[model samples]
Target: MESRSKAHVSWCILLEITVAVLFCSNAQAAPLKITLDTYRNCIDGSILSFSVSCCPGVELDLNVTVVDFIPKRDRLSGHRIRKALQCLTGEELRTYTEKLTRAYELMRALPSSDPRSLHQQELTHCAHGTGSFVQDGLKADSNFTLDIHSSWIFLPWHRMFIYFHERILQKLLDDPTFTLHFWNFDNGLDGRTSSTEGCSEPGHFFPGIYNDNSTSTFEPSRSNRTRVLNVPIDLTFPVMFSEADPAVALRCVNEAVPRNREAMHLAMQKGRVSRDFFGIPFRYGDVRPPMLVGGGSLEYFPHNSLHDWVGGFMRTPLRATGDPVFYPAHANVDRLWDVWMKLGDGRELLQPTDPDWLDAEFLLWDENRVLRRLKVKDVLNIADLGYSYEKVYDASWIFWQNSTGLVSSAMAPTQP
Candidate 1:
């Protein structure tokens, strides 16, 4: 009996040792996940949206306000600005992004996920409550029903959303240097707009590899068919936004769609441009009144020239929600504006002759009855904004010039 008891004790000890080893191995093997704590350390001076005179080693801790996921009816109708204020506080934004970044990290860590996978999921599942804005209950036509005049609201709304998400990442991972990639179209290397690249299979970067299972359905009309090239970075990536490294940011920028100048020119030449408010479509070519150009009146502004202007006009329900690329496409347009401002000789870019286009009343941020108008020249230098972005292609590569005079639809090889 004594010997049997001793043997049992030995077995139990051995079992405990094996379990300990197994647990340690599993802990070591697990892929690194982006956590809120990790995000905090990555904060850098570049991520601050507003100006700060004094630099501190620790970021300003956010003051968060908890509210319902959606705004209350009274708040939505009665005091929209106040409600917006409730939603737009620093803490709320940080929490929102932290959750989003966590979701992205989870998706990325999955065995077989990629940018394409995330896109398909966004269209079908509405990852960010984007489905709330979908009018037709169809994922494919998400951006189709947006109101044109709501550019004022939509721009701020999306920017706020992005900001909130970024803040959450900063809070979680403790990284401030982590920044976002603004899609640039001015140089025209984006994969989406360029026919030389397969418009349907747009590229993206993942911190790690995963199997891509997303399916693509092709369409003939640019509206009916989704263009994959120049597709925006999936709002979802595995890393917390604050934890994302410069390389990751660069990859996101590099994968964006290139602008299609020919397509844009043809669309404009055909007089398909129109304007709208909120989600409702207005009269074609009548959105903005004639502006003085070279001491004469002109209906169209050179700055607004792009293929999307045509698509923006001809489509009914002028605001687009069905297209996954809409936000990114607009972002690319904004990026081009940023790039052109940088390259167009800073002083010359701000000479606003068009009254409709260059009105002083156009305010980027309005608080306390003080309106701040953003000049075309002021945005020309993003570096002055304390942020610089990576170019689409490497500096060593030859610039892509559309001098062929022939439009060919083929996927071009991506420059490494």
Candidate 2:
């Protein structure tokens, strides 16, 4: 009878363990939810409702606050920018590129589920939560390229990229509550500081805090102005060259060009320029020689330079790699343009005055098409595109009447 009791006890313990395992498995199977909102305030002085859609459950009405974002500070200063560039051994450069390539692949492979699909999933699972939207053909890799030439082309490409990414979040989560906030850097008016003295403010709408040491400065200019080969190469070069191995391209940047923090710090000197393929010189600013014009110099300088400048020289054919940062940098440039528009006398600049600029067309996509051509007049008013950014200078600050007005007006407001 004692032996029979011992066997029965052992069986009971085994049954308990199985039950515990099943319970834990069920707990781990919960679905994910996301939500996104705009930065503007509502009628109650709360954050404005940009849009709020969600996946899976009951949606709650909440006010989201929009604040200025800042990048982490870097300590390196002066000639460090040039020194860093020289320090980039070919091997280091290769590794850095590889990592960017991998990031591209991962972003591209994100599941192509829209808001409706997520909502249905939520109903089926009976999960309680909200999430952001997702969209089609909205992968991040499509924008990375050192080969981009015209500032006009570069700026719009990034703007569209940011818009598409935000739209994707809205589609996936169906939460219009989700909104993207940008870093305000004009004259540091918002009191938002950057980790790198030479680094410009981050632009485009990115969710969450990102602290990647991917910024570089090559002095004489506020940022490095490297000219890349303008000649287009076979779009399939990366794929074909690697025997269609995605790993090959990723390895090139990841292991070769590890992020160079010190070098990045050194790159932000005044009067620095980077040479691209065939040795074309590029610099920052709107001045005659393109002086360093960060922290708000004037519209005629860098603002005009952005539209007038073109990438020159072609040592070799250029191919696109999948690095997400490329688009953000250009987006930063566009944001600067937005700031410049507010600084000017609220008058539109005539592009037709410059023959070369007038003939140029910016290639981009509208909401319905793949590639659409736009002119200088098409994008001048970013607000028309359904977005308005917080001014670096508040209305309480002095209003500038001209480029020089930035200083004079700040000292004393122009009374009406």
lDDT of each: 0.26, 0.26
lDDT, candidate 2, equals: 0.26
lDDT tens digits, residue span 1-416, model 1: 99999999999999989744422222222111112221122221111122111111123221222222211221111210101111123785465344434544543343322222222222211211211222222323323221112222222223333323333333334544434333222332334344342121222321001112131211123321123333333221112123233422322343322223332232122121111111111111222111111111001121222222223221211223232223333444334333333442232333333322222111211111111233322333334333433344211112334433432231111100
Best by lDDT: 1
lDDT of 2 at 348: 32
Candidate 2 regions with alpha-carbon error over 4 angstroms: 1-107, 110-161, 172-178, 185-208, 212-330, 345-376, 393-416
Tens digit per residue, CA lDDT, model 2, 6-64: 99998988888874442222232211111221101111110012222322223322233
Tell how far residue 135 is off in model 1, in angstroms. 24
TM-score of 2: 0.30
